[model samples]
Target chain A: METQLQLLNTQGFKHTIRRLCYELIENHNTFENSIIIGLQPRGVYLSSRIVKELKEITGLSNLVNGKLDTTFYRDDFRRRSNPLIPNQTEIDFIIEDKKVILIDDVLYTGRTIRAGLDAMQAFGRPKKVELLVLIDRRYSRHLPIQPDYVGRVVDTITSDSIKVKWDEIDGQDEVLMFTDNVEKI
Target chain B: MSALSVRHLLGIKEIQASDIDLIFSTANTFKEVINRPIKKTPSLRDTTIANLFFENSTRTKLSFELAEKRLSADVINFAASSSSVSKGETLTDTVNNILAMKVDMVVMRHPYAGAAKFLSRQVKATIINAGDGAHEHPTQALLDAFSIHEKLGSIKGCNIAIIGDILHSRVALSNIFCLQKLGANVMVCGPPTLLPKYINELGVRVETNLKKALEWCDVANMLRIQLERQDIKYFPSLREYIMLYGLNMPMLESLKKEILIMHPGPINRGVEITSEVADSHQSIILNQVENGVAVRMAVMYLLAGAKQ
Candidate 1:
């Protein structure tokens, strides 16, 4: 039997998102020249929610948002048994000389972000790049990557896994941490 | 979080249907990557790959090398003509010597069938079969199926006819296996003498008449007759074979349903197909060639990324 703990409920999740939107507005007054790219599979959900909040609060309707697939750019692609399931990467606009914000659901070993950075190079060289994540798992990063914006932080052991569920995808909005039976660290 | 299951891509027979879908999915991402400005990824950084070709090749060799470079892997080329095999060295010795230099993977093309499979067992490094004689060219089949899937929107229920020298084509064998696994209706169209003996056992239909085959198929993959592989004449003559099996504009236009034209190239332009049909809008030969790089990249990346 694994131990499960609820970290954030619907109300708390909404509050954290609204706060994060304000923080983003504080830094970026108007995202006229900035683009938001969500990492595929899970990050797109969180990024889409954030974009909706940003639009309601900041009235920024012309924001450029796209999904970035990091499947082919992953480093540990050969370290497992099952075949990879890839998602669509639909970036129709240019990232050249634009401030790019990369979004994901959770931050753990930071390998996915590293792959995202490598993948973004194929599009064009961005003037500046920033990372944003909803949940940040501290003391577990393999790479020296730090997110520019974060919703929540939690300290976890190697045997623990953090899962974020969105209402759009999972029919509920919440964050959960499971301990024991974590296969991959 | 998904990864390729096989360490070595030896042939289509060794791969599952789901694996083919995975390769196409990964190749889809790579195809987008190649179209971008940078056209390179650092996924395989610090990894070294050696391309060992025991046979003469133009497209496969160059495509594999280019795919390696695009993945940011250190690449080394070895051809039998320039290597120590000319100095009476054995295949094992040549490969072992190269492995001693610390190569992590090998993309090999050999003149004999089962060469890649044998080498995979002997070597500690990953082996990708570029082509192993008449046994299989898994990557080519993959790219062909991918191109068809891209153009036709789905592979299932599509009638694909492989026309030409079915007796001695690795491409034909691999394509039949792959297309059948993906639920496509496959047929082999060629001269009776040039057809394989046990082709029926493989669950593929054989059509001797080229006109009926072309009219029946949604896509026609014209194969080059392997003149070098034939020890004796399998057909009456080149002109007779062309008269019976050759694909021309009038014959294709008569099909009326806009059948897609394809070829595994180094094309004998006027032999298997005319230049007009090869260059027409209905032809996806160039798309197949372009998809070859992405498919090979996906294969190499998945194979190299597999666990030892």
Candidate 2:
């Protein structure tokens, strides 16, 4: 966090957040029956942070603790002998009637969110599903999907990539864009 | 053994040697899958596999379900509710209803050991027994054997000790058959009451003490002691049971460092084996968990594919 916060200060992200929040509040801050759901593993943490921030900003606490394993939906199962254990996607609240805002850490190929959608149908259909990703690495759009919100717009070549480090999983918070050169790192 | 040739893997021992060869070979084909740029393939596309577990199942059901989805087969899941079975419906009826859907496969777990084997003959779809009536959980044995071969380069003459719950575990029985079939020397250990007297007929030695068994083996498979269902009073108490049969840190320290440890989890942390020993560098439980999915994928593919 110290490193990321330092980097954000240097990169001027806090300044942007201050400006963006006001713009977000002024123009687009109304929803009838909305809930935020996080994708599992790390997205669970990402969505929860967003929920807390959103609640603090808008006094909304009707956030849902939902996780999607979507291991079943991945295109490559023949390769994965033991897919990630499907964790329980517990949403006691009715999903069919709500306008759900899906939250995730990184929106790469958009496959995870696509799988999350398949998992969501089991609970019930949401009226609308808007996606929020922490980082948007503009790449191949395999599934015709786009994030409704992106915290950072990072452009990169295929070999060089944006890697996210969160304290929950990586014990630090910093988004690093690096080349995947074996010799480089 | 083409790994992806299986249709549905219901049990290990139920199938012929040809099928086992098929599963192993198929698994080997996709062995490089783990290293691929994207680890996935669509094999069981559009097929539905429901994990109808009437008992708590962790590795077996999860492995099979993952294997199915990886193959592109759709997976439906159900577990024994604390209350559902008692109110209505028999295992046969439930299984039949699932089979009636003409689903590709039904991965089942029941308290009765031979239930999966019996269900296999009756169902049109394949029935892979997760575990039943202390009869056998064939896939666990297969994965264990696979892990052994992968580590030792062969299963021949490996000293294997299956400790705890032989009287109540299908894993112990399946290991006996698979290890013997794969040419490993097998030994069974636990309290006198927990082991059947005639267990030696399965071509393995039986001993009562754990240290003796631990000292004599290259691989030790610690079975989870189901504490809730021990109505017959096998051991005097849990503390006594741990003292006698539990593999603690000291016991692990006493063993040969090269020895590979294994457990079919969710482990009874401090009971059958301590957390240190279970999570120790010696443990192959996690490896077993990994291989299980591959083995099941091999099993499922072989069962469903070759006949076609």
Candidate of highest TM-score: 1
Tell me the tens digit of each residue's lDDT in model 2 across B141-257: 888888777777878889999999888777888888888866789999999999988998877899998999989999999998866556778877889999999998887787765
- Candidate 2 achieves a global lDDT of 0.70
For candidate 1, write residues A1-185 as lDDT tens digits. Answer: 57888879999999998998888788777997789999998999988998999999988798899999897778776456653556788898889999999999899999999999988887888999998989999999999999999999888888788889888868899999898653422
Q: If scored against the real structure, what TM-score would every candidate get?
A: 0.93, 0.59
| Residue A51 displacement in candidate 1 (angstroms) | 1.9
DockQ for each numbered candidate:
0.50, 0.01
Q: Which stretches of candidate 2 lie over 4 Å from their true place?
A: A1-185, B1-11, B16-21, B34-37, B82-87
Candidate by candidate, in order, the iRMS in Å equals: 2.7, 13.0
List ranges where model 1 is wrong by over 4 Å: A71-87, A139-144, A179-185
lDDT of 2 by residue, A1-185 (tens): 11111223324443433443344345336544666678876778766655555567877565455555564455554444432333335455667877787777778878888887875665667788888777786865578889877777665446665666666677666666665443423
True contacts kept of 1: 0.61
Native-interface RMSD of candidate 2: 13.0
**lDDT score, residue B256, model 1?**
64
